[model samples]
Target: MRKYGRTDEASSALAVQLRSYPANERTHYKHAVHQHFSHRNEPLTKEDITQALCQLNGQKGGNKS
Candidate 1:
């Protein structure tokens, strides 16, 4: 079983996505990607995901602050 930072529905979805990765790469990938994004230094809130998606689609997210 995999461990996640939170147990809410959104966190569950993230866990499911992580689980889809190959077993050999799962832990390291999750630790590196998720931990970096979710760390307090950057603080990945739900808003960050939305902002990222917008940026990916060529739309600019409003000011970071």
Candidate 2:
């Protein structure tokens, strides 16, 4: 079964999305997540959401082979 914690859910979805894209695109996504989460107390923009998704994808991949 998939372990679905609040943080896990976000990263899991990001990983699936990353599998659909090329390597270079993943970097942009990672940067966005880092920027947004780093300043999470502030408002998130559309770009921030996009970035978070990217970051999640990369993080998920790192956990696997």
Candidate 3:
């Protein structure tokens, strides 16, 4: 099971969309969920989102033997 939250069509679509973006413009799961619910009053900025993206993206590829 996915650790982040529930797995649904909307979240799957957003994950695909977010993965398509360059790491510089990637969105965070938390922030994405917040925005999805129109939580504009959340205490977070665009920079934080991008940072989370970079961090997660950085783990995408590796040789596991």
Between 1 and 2, whose TM-score is larger?
2
Model 1, span 1-65: residue lDDT tens: 23434336545554565566569855654455454455444334455444434343343336465
Instruction: Look at candidate 2 and tell me the lDDT of residue 5.
Output: 20
Note the clash tally of each candidate.
0, 1, 0
Q: How accurate is candidate 3 locally (lDDT)?
A: 0.50
Candidates' C-alpha lDDT: 0.48, 0.56, 0.50
Runs with alpha carbons beyond 4 Å of true place in candidate 1: 1-7, 41-65
lDDT of 2 by residue, 24-64 (tens): 77767645555556634444444545666745756867645
- The model with the greater TM-score, 1 or 3, is 1
Scored by TM-score, the top model is 2
Query: What TM-score against the true fold does each predicted structure earn?
Result: 0.41, 0.43, 0.33
| Tens-place lDDT digits, model 3, residues 12-64 | 55566587666765555546554444533434344444554455555554433
RMSD of each: 8.6, 10.6, 10.8
The worst-scoring run of ten residues by lDDT in candidate 1 lies at 52-61
